[model samples]
Target: MKLFRIVHPLNGVQRLLLTVWVGAMWAIGYVAAPVLFAAIESRMQAGAIAGTLFSIVSWIGLLCGGLILLVQWRARHRGLSRVALSCIIAMLIITGVGQFGLQPMMADIKAQFPAGVEMSGELRSRFGALHGISSTLFLIASMLGALAVWRSAPTDL
Candidate 1:
């Protein structure tokens, strides 16, 4: 919407903030995906994936997040400009779908997990550890974005 550009402002600070937001989303997605995948892996209630879907999907999501940020930077550089940023923003809109879109789909997956299968406490904890590391990476990406913005970019024509 027009309100986002108006409110967020396309200055250095905003650009950095935008990058942080995107990065965090990716990190969290990776972390969460594994947790969900492990849970699904444990249940193995007939229809579960033979390999890891969430794991790959999560990695893809992370990659996409970085790519999208690059797209934003390119847009700022007057390459794609506002149109590029808008398209990237539209892509980010998919990121927001997680709060709603993903959870519902995952609920069905959770239900598919059979009760009797035993998943070790350590495995669950390890997944948590991965989540933590991935989350830290996410934060690091945000910090990098802020640094990139604050350091000054070449705006000369």
Candidate 2:
């Protein structure tokens, strides 16, 4: 007995892209970030590695989110399309704020402090606050991406 239905080729492609994008976000944000800190002896080195990885993830997110939006826009499923659109927009915004706005400020703070100097001052407080906000935004974006993936998955539809 046949147990599965064939979906449009575009649906498969879209789902694959979304899965990879969401998985990468989780891996980079949750896994790699912590690993870098644990493995690297220097805080600056760990931060640099994590920053580079996050920047790459942000760019990949933009491309994948844009592609998902384009495909969903042309799809016949209006409700799904709307949901995907909203989630993608939110993800994009969160990524922009985290990567463009917060990351740079944090980097600037790091630069202000001398090497081997513990960050203990107004700069440290600001950096810590921005880092918290950035982390929260990344988590939110990951959840929103997962939502888009769920809405786009192929099954009965």
Candidate 3:
């Protein structure tokens, strides 16, 4: 089809997008976040910085995922598998839930406390629970992203 023809040449671009997106997920989640916590004296400040990084990565995932999905959908007949498509969709959904759903709830909890102050009691428990869920979701998405990158190899199809 015309769409496939238009998108066919984007195979390399799609792979590049996937690499960047997944690489960022791994770097920020595993590397930078931990460093921020360990190096920064103020837990609140460290958390704020890590949260911002996560938010940026989430946005990147959404954009790259959208574009990759468009390319994959258009070129589906050319060798791109449904599994790859499904992985991207799953990643997008996870990112959306983290960004739109869980992050706001966590933010609201944080907002209840004074600046530079650590949360405690019921608020601390609630925030911790939400953070745990968000972290689990992020980990799942990162794993899926790794799988997707592997599957995108030229010979894998």
Better of 1 and 2 by lDDT: 2
Q: Compute each candidate's TM-score over C-alphas.
A: 0.35, 0.84, 0.90
Put down candidate 2 lDDT per residue, 5-100, tens digits, no spaces: 766777766777778888899999889999999999998789888989999998898888777777767765443556766887898888878778
Give the poorly placed runs of model 2, Cα more than 4 Å off. 1-6, 74-81
Ranking by lDDT: 3, 2, 1
lDDT of 1 by residue, 35-138 (tens): 65577745444224421443344445445545656655655653333543454444444433532354344444444435665344655455445445544544
Model 3: per-residue Cα lDDT over 50-154, one tens digit each: 999999999999999988888766877354456766788899999999999999999999999889788999999999999999999999999999998888777
Residue range with the least summed lDDT across 10 consecutive positions in model 1: 1-10
Ranking by TM-score: 3, 2, 1
Cα-based lDDT for every prediction: 0.45, 0.81, 0.89
Candidate 2, clashing residue pairs? none
User: Where is model 1 more than 4 Å wrong at Cα?
Assistant: 1-10, 25-80, 114-154
